[model samples]
Target chain A: MDDLPSLPAKLARLRHAHPGDFNLSRIDPAAQPCSRGGKAADKVRVEELAVELDGLQNRFWADRRHRLLVVLQGSDTSGKDGTVRGVFGRMSPLGVHVVSWKAPLGPERERDFLWRIHAQMPGNGEITVFNRSHYEDVLVPVVEGDLRGKALQRRYRQINDFEQMLTETGTVIVKFMLHISREEQRVRLQERLDDPEKAWKFDPKDLEVREHWDDYQRAYRDAISATGTRWAPWHVVPADSKTHRNLMVATVLKATLQSLDLRFPPLPKGLAGVRVK
Target chain B: MDDLPSLPAKLARLRHAHPGDFNLSRIDPAAQPCSRGGKAADKVRVEELAVELDGLQNRFWADRRHRLLVVLQGSDTSGKDGTVRGVFGRMSPLGVHVVSWKAPLGPERERDFLWRIHAQMPGNGEITVFNRSHYEDVLVPVVEGDLRGKALQRRYRQINDFEQMLTETGTVIVKFMLHISREEQRVRLQERLDDPEKAWKFDPKDLEVREHWDDYQRAYRDAISATGTRWAPWHVVPADSKTHRNLMVATVLKATLQSLDLRFPPLPKGLAGVRVK
Candidate 1:
C-alpha cells in the first residue's frame, strides 16, 4: 500500500529527532534526495508531482476537513519563492495561498513575534505555503545576538506548542528546512547580483546576514532540533540543485497529501442525486 | 524629599506579589487607595496631574532613552476610555500615544495572540497607553473555555517572557488590573442601553462576555497572578469611581516619569549657547 523507500527514507534521514541529535554541517546540499537519475529526469518528476498535487489538492479542497501548511524555510537565495512556483504553480490559486515573510516592520514588530504568522494560517481544506516563517524569528535574532540562551529555547517551545495546537485543531503541517551549502549560496547570491533579471531581489542587508552564514547554519540546526515534533516534523531538503529542490519538495507534498486519504466530499443530505437547478 | 504615603503605599497594597499571593475576590471594588478626601478634590487633582504629566512628557520626549508602557485591563465600562481622557487630556500628544486593543479580527486573529500587541509597543522617549491589552488573550480564552490548565499556564509564561523582553530593552511597563464589581458592571451596561449617546459603544457580544462575569473574574485573577513579574508588576486599581481611576492613573504616571529624572540632551556638542540665526 505504501511506496515508502525513495521518499520517506530520505525524509527520515533528514528528519531531526531532537535538539541533541541533529548536525547541519555534514549534510551535503548537492546530494539529491528522492532523485530519479539526473537533472532532466528530476525536472520531469517535478512536473508529474505537480500534476498529482493538483489532483490531490482538488480533492483536498473538496474534502474540506484538513488544512495543509507547507513551510519552506532557508537562507536568502535558497529558492523559497521559486519552490512555491515550481512545486505549487500548477495548483489552482483559489485553494493554494503563498505568504512570503519579511522583517517585521512597524506594525508587525510592535507586538509579540508570532502575530503576523498566525494571522496568515490557511483555513480548512486550503493549502498555505510559507516562503519563510516564524522560524526566522528564532534565526535572525539568534545570529544577531539579539536573543540568546533561554529566550531562544522559549521561542522553540512556543513554536512547538503552537504547531501542536494547530495539528490538534486540523492543520496538517509539513516543514522543510532547505539545506544549501555556503559555496552554493555564494554562487546563487552572485547570480542574484550578476543577472539583471535577478538583481532586484538582492538586498545589501542580506550580505550582512550572509556574513553570519555559519552562524545561521548553526541557528537553523538548533531551531530544527528544538522545534521539530511528531506532529509537525521538519524535513531537510537539499536545495543546491533547483530541479532536485523542486522535485524533493513536490514529491514530499504528494506523499503528504496522499497519506490523508482525501476524497471529493459526498453530496449534501437530500442532494445526493440532484442535478443543477 | 519623597511624598510616599499618598502614592507608593497605595501601589504597594495593590501590587500583586505573585500568582499565589493575590486574591481578586477579597479586594473591594469601591475601595479608594489614593483618593484625596472626595470626588471634587480628586477631579481637581487629576487636572493638576495632567498639567504635571504634560511637563514630564516634554522631558520624557527629550530624554529619548526610556520608553513607558501603561497597560489597562478591566471589564467593560471599567473607565479605560474615561481614564485616558481625564489623565492624558493635557499631555502633548507628540510624546503620548494610546493604543486601544480590540478583539483580534481577521488579520490579528490569524497570528499568535501577541503580534498585534507587540506591534503597538512604544518607541524610546515615548509613553504608550494600552486601553486594553495582551492580557485579554489569557482572560477571554479562559472565560470562553478555549484554553485550560497547562495551555493557560503557558500563555501566562509567554506574557511574562514578552514583558521581560520589553523591560530589558528599555521599556518600563506598568500593568493595571482595573477592579470593578459585578454590580458596577450592571449599572454601566444599563447606562450604555439607557443613554442613546453611549449606545454605539455597546457590543451585543460584550453582554455574552458579561454573562461569564465570574469566570472572567477568575480568569483575570489567574492572569494577574501568573503574569505579574518584578519587571512588570500588576496594580489592581479599584475602578468604581471614574474620578479616582483617572486620578490614580495620572498620579502613577507622574511618579513613574519623575523617578526617571529625565533631562534634555545637553545642547548637542557645540550648540550649548548658540542662538538661532
Candidate 2:
C-alpha cells in the first residue's frame, strides 16, 4: 500500500462499494491489503497507531463536539473481541465504551430490532464500539430464512435512514466487517478446542452456524451492499492474520479520528493563572 | 477502630434504618465512622479492599446466578464519581457498568422516572453502578415542592415495592448516600472554578442548587428514610475526606459481596479433563 497518500484515500480502496460488481467470494480473506510491511512491522505499527489513537481520543473527549460510533460485524471467531482490545484498549475507559450485542431477550425482543441499538449510541465526546451490532438483524434473519424479499429490504432501508440521522446529528460512524476464510476459522476453532483456556470461548453453536457458511456469506454480502451508504460505509477487512487485522483497524480508526480535527476546548475565562487555594 | 471482627459487622454501624429518628442534621459529615485508621492507613486499606473486591467481582461474573446494583446518591461535590473510581475501578469493565444519571431529557421525561432506571438494571452476573439514581425523583421534586403530601408517600411505597420485586428476582441492591458538609462542598466547588482542568465539571447550576442546600438535605433525609429497605439498605458515608469515603464504600461493598457467597459456576460435564483440540 502507498504511504504517501492520505489515510482515508488508502482506506477507501478496501471499502465495499459498487454493489453491482460486489461478490464476497472474490475478496481473499488472507490478503494483507493494509499491511505496512511484514507481520513484525505490522505488529509494531499497530502499537504505534494505538498510542496515536489514544492521544486523539483524549482530545476527542475534551473536544466534546462529536460522537463516534464504531460497528464491528463479522462471523463467529472473526476477531471482534481481538479488534476491540487491540484498537480501543488504549483509550480511557471514561471516554470509550463497548457494547457486546447478544441475542435479544424478554423486553428487548418485544421492541424493534434497532430500539436497543439506538439506546446504546455514543453521546457527544464519547466513542461506543458495538460488537456484532444491528447488522446482525439482516444477516441472521436472511440466513435462517426468517426474513425475505421486501421485509429484508425494508430493514436495510431502516438502518440506512437511522444511520443517516445519526450522522446528521454529529455522529461519525465507521463500520468494519472482519472477513476471515473458512479454513482460517476451522484452525481457530480447533485451537479453541485444544486450549483449555480458550475452551470457554468456543460455543458449540458456532459449529451449527459454520454449517450455514455459504448462506451467511451471501446474506452478509447482500446486507452490506444494501446498507453501506455514504454516511456509514462498510470496510471489509481481510482478517486471517490477527496482526494485520489489528493494524488495518487501528490505521482506519486513526485516520477517522484525524479527519475529525479534534481539539480541546479553551480554558474557562479568568482561570488561566487562578490558584486552587 | 477494631479490625478483629468480620467486615460486615464493622460496616453494620453505618447502615441507616431508624426512620422515626432519622435526622439529616444529626449525622456528622466529617465523622470517619467506618475508617480503619488514619487518612494514610485508610487510603492503603481502600486500595487493598478494592483489589479484594475485584477478585470477588470475577467470581460474581463467572457465577452468573446473581445480579448486583449499586446506587450512589449525594449532593454536588459529594464524590459519586470518586467512589466509582476508587471502589469499583479495579474490576473488569466487562462485568462492571456505570450509569451517570443527569436531568431527564427528551423521551426520558415523558415516561416515569423509574422507567429509564429499570431499563439499565444489571443482567445476571453483572454489577451496575448508578452514579445518581432513581432516588433523585424524590429529592429534586420534593425540594422544588413538586411532590408532597399523599403523592410523596405513594412514591415511597412504590419504591419499596419496586425494590422488593428486584430482590425477589435475585438482584442484590446496595445504596450509598455520600454525605458531605456544606462548607466542604463550597471549598470543592471553588477549587473546580480555580482549576482549569476541573472547570468543565463545575456546572453553574451547582451554585443554584447550593443555595437550596438545607432543602435538599431535608429531601435526602426523607427519601433515604422512606426508600431504604432491608433488601436495599442505605449506608450514609462521610465523604469530606476523599480517602475515608472510598474506604467506607469499599469496606461496605467488600462486606456486601462476601454476604452473597459468590462462587464460580461448575465447568461443563466432560470438559473438566477434555482436550480442546
Q: Which residue ranges in model 1 land beyond 4 Å of their true spot?
A: A1-6, A17-19, A275-277, B1-277
Local distance difference test scores for all models? 0.77, 0.81
Model 2 segments more than 4 A misplaced: A1-62, A82-98, A102-116, A145-158, A180-202, A214-230, A235-251, A263-277, B1-9, B17-59, B85-95, B105-113, B146-154, B263-277
DockQ values, each candidate: 0.01, 0.14
- Candidate 1: DockQ? 0.01
Per-residue lDDT of model 2, residues A1-277, tens digit only: 1121346565565776433335767778998877867888888888888778878887898789999999999998999977876777655455677788998999999999999999999889988989899999998888998999999989888998999899999998888999999888888887777665465577777878999989999998898888777678788889999998898888878877887777756556655554332
Shift in Å, residue A189, candidate 2:
4.2
Supply the TM-score for candidate 1.
0.50
Q: iRMS for all predictions?
A: 22.1, 4.5
The alpha-carbon lDDT assigned to residue A36 of candidate 2 equals 69
Q: Which ten residues in a row have the lowest lDDT in candidate 1 chain A?
A: A268-277
lDDT of 1 by residue, B209-250 (tens): 777888988888888878777788787888998888877777
